[model samples]
Target: MYKISICVISFVFLFFLSVSLFTFSMNFLLNELTYFIEWEVVTLNSSSIVMTFLFDWISLMFMSFVLLISSLVIYYSKEYMAEDYNINRFIMLVLMFIMSMMLLIISPNLISILLGWDGLGLVSYCLVIYFQNVKSYNAGMLTALSNRIGDVALLLAIAWMLNYGGWNFIFYLELMKNDFDMMVIGALVMLAAMTKSAQIPFSSWLPAAMAAPTPVSALVHSSTLVTAGVYLLIRFNCLLENTWLGQFLLLFSGLTMFMAGLGANYEFDLKKIIALSTLSQLGLMMSILSMGFYKLAFFHLLTHALFKALLFMCAGAIIHNMKNSQDIRNMGNLVLQMPLTASCLNLANLALCGMPFLAGFYSKDLILEIVSLSYLNMFSFFLYFFSTGLTVCYSLRLVYYLMTGDFNSSSFMPLNDEGFVMLKGMMGLVIMAIIGGSILSWLIFPVPDMICLPSELKLLTLFVCLLGGISGYLISNVSLMFENKALNYYSMSNFIGTMWFLPIISTLGVINYPLKSGMMILKSFDQGWSEYFGGQMLYNSLKMNSSYNQLFQNNNLKIYLMSFIFWLIILTSLLII
Candidate 1:
């Protein structure tokens, strides 16, 4: 039954891969092929509601990658989760997540996209809480509610789309590009994407969501869920071009990249550091998309999915061997014990850092070069290069703790790379991580252009890469001699490690005061005043009146008739007066 899940997912992945390859070849040889299936559900007062699925090269390509990674994750889970009692449930939840991502990819209609968008949120919540622990529960809640903001934003977008007499937003994008109503819709959609992508203010949930199983993290954080927002923006690129909202997104996303990169450097948890790396990549994708480079953004998104998934798989292998100790500080000299996993880790890390001729080089380096060519302000330029450097910084830091430094864990701790099932999954992505970028860049961007830029500027990416490597190497070794000095900066360390207190602000700041106020209102009104005035007091008074009436009714009928007549006389006198 455990292996059956992997087989089913593999078949699904193969089917999608075949379709995607055929579509890509066809599109390359001919023109772009976009297939749309629509069913009219109803028409009311000249307005219509329809379900639409638009499958293009972009959607098919992304769907293929998503299914591919999911299959690998499922296979990897065979070893990582072998002893789990609820492995099937976890596999099913993962499949559900992949299906949601596929739905999000294919749907062009705003209303139809909601099905996938909400599905991703709900299924992610399920995945995050799969462990059935308090930490998982809280992380799941945070993940679900944080994404709910985007869900609401999307709903608002659908409402705004009503101005076009239909929910098919793609059809009206061009017509409404300059319209005020369209701008509003675009802003709402951008906000929705920002939340899903974990940009800036909504950034905390990505790392917090690492409470899920490692396989789930590989699929969700690395490739599928976090990239959904970038995909959304890629689809809506036309609507956002030259808009102030787009510029605002560029600014915030740059900050997000910087913030996440900085946070990862100070973080100790292995999964969290990877999670923050994913966050930083997401910011990179969002910032590029905000700059109207949809194709480049999509290109980076694809290459990133390949390498980042591999990275997580390696992290999973390490964590599994470490007996679930996620603190990287406890890991060192692992290359001696787990050569295969260490090789995979270093390879993926290099790809992530944009090493020359690797997967990230073709896309990430190009993106950096493009950013440099543009007229960026001081802040934006600093954000870009510093974030780039930080990528290398953290990657080196991670390597030092995991592979290069002295063996720091218990000498007898059992750890090895004999999990061939896990190795198989990682090896599949390793091939892609090595060659995915070059192939994708050539296929996506066939025509090469000449840049009339200075040699220094052309080599800036390499320079930053070298600088980051040097900085990381120095910081890693220097910290051993200055342990107390490192500890002395407790306040600053907390701020950076906590992601500039963004998590506190997103969780406690956003919800605590309001929740406390709600509790107070419940105490004062529902429990106190409403109970006294509307329930207990009214019931007691009615009971007393009923008792008095019962006592009076015990008298004789003649006395009652006399009393009624006297009361009637008094009423008549009062009415006359």
Candidate 2:
């Protein structure tokens, strides 16, 4: 046991070290790879293929977040899963997930990209059901099934692209210039991304996935599985450039952001509240990315990873101290007991709410600026604005619920802080959440000219941050005054909570209603046809034919052989004809 523990520890440290090195050397790696410039060597069947260096500014930005979040989540979970029965299996799955995500980030072809995508989905199922509970099992199954539907769509799109575009490889740089069936392929890819990212109509699986441990939720939701879709879409931004499909993606993303934010506000379970908020933030990120602001989207993805993981880990620490109860209403005055955890939580929440000077402020405000700059249509701008408001509301509610309520002494377990390993992981992410945006802007973009935000836009961003935080505070305070009974009157909120059923019912109605009516008409036609054909007589002949039964009896071998020969001859004649 001791040896196994040491080996696992050593492996984790090595993996994290490699990731950090990779992130720092990303530009050099891309430059070196690009210098070689051999696109002809790699071929699919007889088709010539172009393989470009994928470690571009955008890919490197996402890779940094992926490595940072994934490493921290793994580190935190080492202590988080200390007492679990299947610790080795858990660690194995985590490593595989990280490796697959790395491969996904650097993939140069569509087939290779799908390989990583599917691998992440596969391991996600294992992590989700690691607890081996009925709920976890069911949630994992649903998530897998939903993701498989998206995978099928993706595969179909790949086939369609190959057939129409005559491009056997799905290299973004090559496919960018191709015009044939780009719309169809783009729409299918969007559908695939929507499901993977847990956008509306497919978002329930994520909330259900809260059955997993906090670290798994933090890793999968914050950095890996959900982000894959955004990464895919952004990696192929040229395909989405100036298209109606792009507009559709932007609108859908806006709708998901608003709906998910509302859901997060209504939720009380600690992990789930955070889960839904992550979904909302991802939705906002998708909206930004879909609008052709790849840099802004990458920035938001970076900030969101740091803060969301920190938030989940902090919530996990709280849950650990509270004897595994995740109900925030049952939590209060925790700031007084768990100062370190509370401080981290507050920092993360501040970033999430887009308070000025925090990482989220820089990234999210950039997205808001892009939305304001959008001259495409009024509907897109209004949707983005409304969604941004809800984002503020829910983020504020999360902090208020955990920290400000009256103390519930009954819910408090002995004040036990998380292990040093876990705290170390959370603290690292907290620091990143504070400084990531500035560092990224300095490292990746061209000096002063590449800084996308104008001075006026920068000031507008600060103003929006201030306005959002103040409004969120006011709403949180007012919300405390309402009794739990007041919630019952909010019919719209109830409908939204049960909104998963809406799509299911609509689908069944579309499929079943017409089929039922058609079946009734078909039954009538069948009855009429049977009457015309002496159906009763035929039925009676089959039912009471002693000769027919005798013909099939074991004692009547010659008769059976003759009947088989006649049928074979008829089938052969039909085939020949």
- Models 1 onward score TM values of 0.88, 0.80
Candidate 1 wrongly placed segments (more than 4 Å): 1-30, 40-49, 480-488, 518-577
The residue ranges of model 2 lying beyond 4 angstroms of the native Cα positions read: 2-26, 29-53, 164-178, 409-412, 449-488, 498-577
Model 2 per-residue lDDT tens digits across residues 415-473 = 75647878988988888888876666565443544346567755665555456657767
Q: Which candidate is the best by lDDT?
A: 1
Q: On a 0 to 100 scale, what is the lDDT of residue 443 in model 1?
A: 76
Tally clashes: model 2.
Answer: 0
Model 1, range 476-497, lDDT digits (tens) per residue? 7886666557657667778888
**Weakest 10 consecutive residues of candidate 1 by summed lDDT:** 21-30
Each prediction's Cα lDDT score? 0.87, 0.74
* TM-score winner: 1
